[model samples]
Target chain A: MSDDNQHQETFEDFKNSFNYGSRSDLNFKFLKNLSGEDASHFFQELLWKIGDSFNDGDFTRVVDHVNETQAKAYAGVGRFTYDDSPFTPLRAPLSQLRLGLMTSSGHFVAGDDPKPFGVENMSQQEAETRIDDFLKVEPQLSVIPMDTSIEKLRVRHGGYDVRASMADPNVNFPISRLAELQAEGRIGELASDAYSFVGAASQLRLLNHTGPEWVRMFQEKKIDALLLVPV
Target chain B: MEAGGIPTVVIGVHAFRDRLAAMRLPRTVITPHPMGRTLGAPKDDETQKQVILAALDLLETAQKPGKIIDLPGRYRL
Candidate 1:
């Protein structure tokens, strides 16, 4: 057989092997054991811990008693540690899926683009001056197309040792590797853009707003799946 | 947001495993590495590629929500 025929046959074989029915069949069976009475008890225990083990303290009193660090810690526990959200399943075959990347580490390529995703091209001093405002107005989701040069990339995360990523952006946002996979046919294709967010943000309001907005943007980009690298 | 209809697989540090579990994330693969280097040591292409592939594999094989799998190996500073 000719090379084109062999390639077509292999592609067909892959599609046939993919579990397309898995999406419709998707169910939250992971939480099956935590139901009814058990679930109620579990949530109560979680809540108690988040409230700083409150037994008989007034809300105002509790707020006044805890330090800033303690307050933030408890607040996060109360806000994020919940299992009530719904989940979608991966139904497409790995070979046929279009993948996107998101990093909690604030890494982006610098350039003179009107897209206010990251502080691109400015000196570190200038970027630091504008970082707060940049984070504010910039959309919760930023799109990064593949083939963006590594030379243009920079890491702006304050919460960790960024030296590694500074030397090589792929340490955090491995777009180069993703491109290789695409070329090798290990995956279908990459979305035109990837995304970035500062994971160190402590404000629940900001996260609560941005998280779903990011999801909507991902869906808009027609991404079939996402690989999130969280620092 | 997995519950919101996106299938997300997280490659994160082990330090955040408990918190990630609480957040009820979809498929998660944890490495005993520090915060910033989620893929592996910087410029270590082979290791990074292996790690990325493993996380994608988790996206396919993970059966339920909040599934956390430990990837083999520790990343030293």
Candidate 2:
């Protein structure tokens, strides 16, 4: 019933206290803005999406590409739209689930004396220098590219800057010409909607985790086809 | 694969996750970038079709419960 009582024991204590102690860690962010149950559902959704989308057939080629691209973008179904009701919260063992992960999330856990994923103790003045240093190895993903002709559309999509990485430079900014092509009701013949590679990923793993769900939803809706345009 | 009721398409900007959405009975992957603009608003029908077609391709090939289909050549299509 108490907040601290959720997992009162440390990994060491858990090891000595419970059967799953080795896998348990104190997830600091786990309780932040999370309704426990919804978080659990989200995790369930992760498994389901992978099951429904990953198969051995014509889609074989797509498995890796979609996983890689999205594993680098999106977040938990990218947060439900405003129109929809929020998800439920359930109390579950998050620490036990992420024990073997390479993720920067929940880096501190299960008696290892976890530290916050990134810089934890830098003065405000040194923030820029720190970010610059981090960018050297952990560079940020640019949502928009430099030579993008779809600048206007980027703004239209509701973003401050449309940046992208040099190798995968498919920003959401579609050119006016492309937009024109989409408006004339010509694209739906082959697919449901044209691609718009503009939006920013909330979390790197979100895209990958939520990918199958997107595919399933479109299919269930009888979309017939999809033509990812990649800005 | 007891993923509940009829088939449903799960939409997300990434493919690594969404296991839960897929389990919601039906599932698929999109591997796009942001979640908000899956269809890329303000664009036209042709542009939207690009997103839709790729989605369709997933459904077409998807068979098992945990499929990870990736249309790397999505741009070409």
**DockQ of all models, two decimals each:** 0.32, 0.08
The digit string of per-residue lDDT tens for model 2 on A1-231 reads 668758566433423321112332111122222344544444455556566566633443343443333343333543432222212111122211110001111111122221112544433223322333432232122222222343222221112112221111122322233334435543222222322222323333434444445446444544332232221
Q: Best candidate per TM-score, number?
A: 1
Task: Grade the docking of candidate 1.
Answer: acceptable
List model 1 lDDT by residue over B1-77, tens digit each: 67557788888765566667777777888775555677777778888888888888888887777778888765632
Reference-based lDDT, residue B28, model 2: 45
The residue ranges of model 2 lying beyond 4 angstroms of the native Cα positions read: A1-231, B1-5, B15-26, B71-77
Tens digit per residue, CA lDDT, model 1, A1-231: 568755654422332232121211101111222334543454455466558636554343322222221212222232467755466888887789898889877776665333334444444334344445554543344456677888877666534556778887777889999999889988898888777765555445455776767777788888888999876
| Cα deviation of A159, candidate 2, in Å | 16
User: Over the full model, what C-alpha lDDT does candidate 2 score relative to the true structure?
Assistant: 0.32
Interface RMSD of each: 8.6, 13.8
Q: How close is every model to the real structure, measured as TM-score?
A: 0.66, 0.25
Model 1 lDDT, residue A54, Cα: 67
